[model samples]
Target chain A: MLLSPSRLRGLGSRVPPCSSFRPFTAAAAAAASPTSKPQVYLSRSRNPYLNLSVEHHLLQTTPPDSTVLFLYTNRPCVVIGRNQNPWLEVNLPLLSSLTARTKPGDHEPAPTTIDLVRRRSGGGTVFHDPGNVNYSVICPPESFDRDKHAEMVVRALRGLGVPGARVNARHDIVVDVDVDVDVSESDGNHGANTFKISGSAYKLTRLRSLHHGTCLLSSPNLGSIGPLLRSPAEPFIKARGVESVRSPVRNVGVGNGEFEDAVVAEFAKMYGDPDVFCEVGDEAGAVDGVEKGMKELLSRDWIYGQTPLFSFSTYPTEDDPRERPSLPSDFHLSFEARHGQLSKFTFVNASSAGHVDIPSSSSSSPLDGSRIYDVEDWTDALRSYGGTVNSQAETAGRWLNGLFGTGHAKTQLR
Target chain B: MASIARCVRAARPSVLSTISKPIAATSRPVFYRPTQRCFSATPISEVRKYTKDHEWIDLHADNKTAVIGISEYAAEALGDVVYVELPEEGATVAQGDSIGAVESVKSASDINAPVSLRIVQSNVELEEKPAKINRVPEDDAAGGGWLARVEVDEQGLKEFEGLLDLEAYKEFTATLHE
Candidate 1:
């Protein structure tokens, strides 16, 4: 059954063609009756996968002429891209083991599920917390324009009296923190462009495509994000997945209590008719599809098993000479993986340079500051440590006596 | 290797599980071939034909099978290929339908079927080392850098005729880039 904009409040059980909405062009948009802008859905579910499923559902089922905007939130989690490696993108060990305490020091109510998930789009990874609001735009392939949506976001933020909200060359919405310097004049380092207010990604099917991004209305402070992003446990991990560029991010609605509603109102005014909004779960049958999509997204196979083939290696040297001169400089751990599965795993104290290469593990270390863990045995630890790419790194940490130093660290999968 | 096929199957369970028309046609592991090595047995029998989307399908004398891959212009345009999402061996595709995608530093482009055919073998080497697509000589791309082998009978051969010859496709891509 075809869905007219009027029927959006309810739906037939059957899914429609990819281009099931009204045939729309800019001229047709102007001449069209009533639904002038886009269809808006506000998702109440905080489950990260569920919210993503809702966006994919709309993208998969929506008509070409129709434009859709999904504004939702997720409980804290790290989301990977479709073609990314979780081992390199996130600190997998911290994500799997962290316990979100319901009461102080009580591990029983550990509700924290800070795991990695792969999104069906091409871009870098992103972080989501309850304080962050995500916006996704699904349009016809011809109608998809990331710049327009970026402009709309900046325009909406400006309407909320937020200052210095503008899109940079990378198409990220950055709020200039420095009062003295313009963003363009600053160095290209993402860290210098503090307070990345919005991050976006895009995907295309044969018929329609969608562009989705995160908006920081208010969020747990930026430092809380570093843990989910990467791990300090491993000194460094090298992989070739699409790595997320890191920039200091800030909450747009931090001081203003009304900022969430204000930003929503602004987006509704710009992208939708305030009257034509749909509360995602309000429809009865749609929840099943969202639930299915949610289950699909939450699967371990989808999350970890989809990562591109990569090799990750870490060198453990003197972390800080002033603190611990006892630690030696030549210890290294390396692993090769395809789809997050390990192929070659090795750990060695190479006194000789370039002795430890995968499928050939040959290296011997002096008894100086480093105690020998025997290069031959750690391979078993890494293979057993494997569920996600991040887990393997954690196994290396455990077997070698946490040489890299534990605790959460975050980095992109570049 | 079956491992790569297993990985692809796991990654795209929904699509592969649902499509019942094509039998699993992927070449099981014969042995590890170097990414740079050209298959000496399957040389191009006929001149190359190009799809508007930049894929070149070389149908040797036996019109029943053809080797297909992206064009030199496409390889040049795609920049460095970080990943290539290949189709399952048994999957059957209609002309112009997307079988898989090729991801580069720029963006991911859908790999379309130039004509209706059954996938017989996927280049597992590309899955292991995607840059090989860029490494193969551009002039010999249709022979050296092919992405997959597809089954083409008389009907598939008729469909191949509608595609542009090498010179026409080069001219076509020129107009697009300009």
Candidate 2:
């Protein structure tokens, strides 16, 4: 099952075969072999797509009974759960504008453009940057316990002098910090001291169970996380998938190297010294399976089209009846999306235009079979209705385009 | 297939006695629909088999239909399922292929097919009430926890024959805990 040297050389022509490529490929092959000893890996690449694909490859190809530990850091990204709705969980408008914004009062330039990713694991959305380190453990299903790895990370934190670190009931690692606040306003109602430092999620197959978590160490973008995760369309869309439970989060105040070393030490205590410990990165994309998985992860279909069924109503309905935020126009519009395709759209009240049954993917109309992410201009989509854009249509289209991050005019955050 | 069906029927009472409740103990009613040539044959029976992966399939007497679902053991282990992503109806799959997945406790676990099948219908109601799977995972009744109804081919039947019986499955799970 291991990638042959000849094949690795063929796939990785971009990487010099006589140099570090040999060790990387050897480590990967060792990790992939069923009979090989337990493995540990550290990724030097900051590409979120590559990191996830590499992790997934390890999850699939690693020995069924053997345990694996992978540690890596992504540049900056917003990663959503496999079944979560991007439009409901993420603020698309703000996310699209992040490249132009910098930390408040910081002299350093803004970080690179944030990449949006949809991970195969199921959980709420999370923000990742260089200050955050992600640790993944893949082990046999019989040995899988949700809190096992989280507790290990807590032990690592405690070793690093973070005395308040502990695993919460929800299987996340949190740190208690003294704060002057009312007990009712704090998360988990455990007074105001509890703040999550690591969020855990899992992917389970028949043979292997993979537990991965993000530990916020010293992220400068903590200020932007709250706004980035809060979508303007949250009040309007009633989604049919896992919704995130908001938690107060903070950094554990440790360097990435220090944290990684401590975690590896703790892992060694649990499972003996790794047989192979090496670095992997962009060269991993050279492997055929990894390349394929990377392509799938980077695909538009998996990112947007994999979203579960959801409905959007301008006014409160039976299923999602919360007082909706006020809008510029009083146009009562409703729609439903299945797999990110606009399946149904209705103009319940369009000012003078009584009720108009617009065409969705399920019916015949200008917006037939349109993928929500592909529609860059909602006004253009609505213009085909009645051959002219009315006031109500214009107002709704502009608002929706903004909410869905497809607006023609990108507002510079600078 | 007949021997397996008989074994399942003979073991039904013990199977009911083994599992802890609030697990609905009522077995799905297997009606005897006469085949074109076997009009005088006794009531047709369905055979239920369990996979080591913790899925169960109730193979119809016709040998060409089956209802698939996760076992009660799996449902209890996966606390509070928030969403069930059902497979695409009519998609042909091999025995070990991942047909769909369930999201529970911040984890998404693949639900593999117990046998080769062409999906006919999925339990769409699970999309809205995912907790039903936890409440009655082995129930195949209407509005129950069954994941799909699929068309089983000869290969599928062969695979189904190899799966563990309820008694054997109970023993297998017992060993895992030990």
TM-score of each: 0.66, 0.86
Q: Candidates' interface RMSDs, in order?
A: 11.0, 9.6
Error of 2 at A156 (Å): 1.3
Residues A194-300, candidate 2: write the lDDT tens digits: 88889999998877888999998877677678888999998999998888888877777688877887887777778876665666767877876678887888877
User: Per-residue lDDT tens digits of candidate 1, residues B1-178?
Assistant: 1111111112232322222222122232223344544333433354578776667786755557777776655565455777777777899888878887766532455677888889999887777677877666133332345688889876777788788875676455444422
Best by the DockQ measure: 2
What's the CA error at residue B155 for candidate 2, in Å?
1.0
> Which candidate has the top score in lDDT?
2
> Which candidate gets the maximum TM-score versus the true structure?
2
List DockQ, one per candidate, in order: 0.09, 0.34
State the displacement of the C-alpha of residue B133, model 1, in Å, after optimal TM-score superposition: 6.0
Candidate 1: docking tier: incorrect
Over 4 Å off, model 1: A1-37, A99-112, A179-193, A233-236, A254-276, A282-292, A313-333, A346-397, A400-414, B1-56, B71-82, B88-98, B104-109, B120-146, B153-178
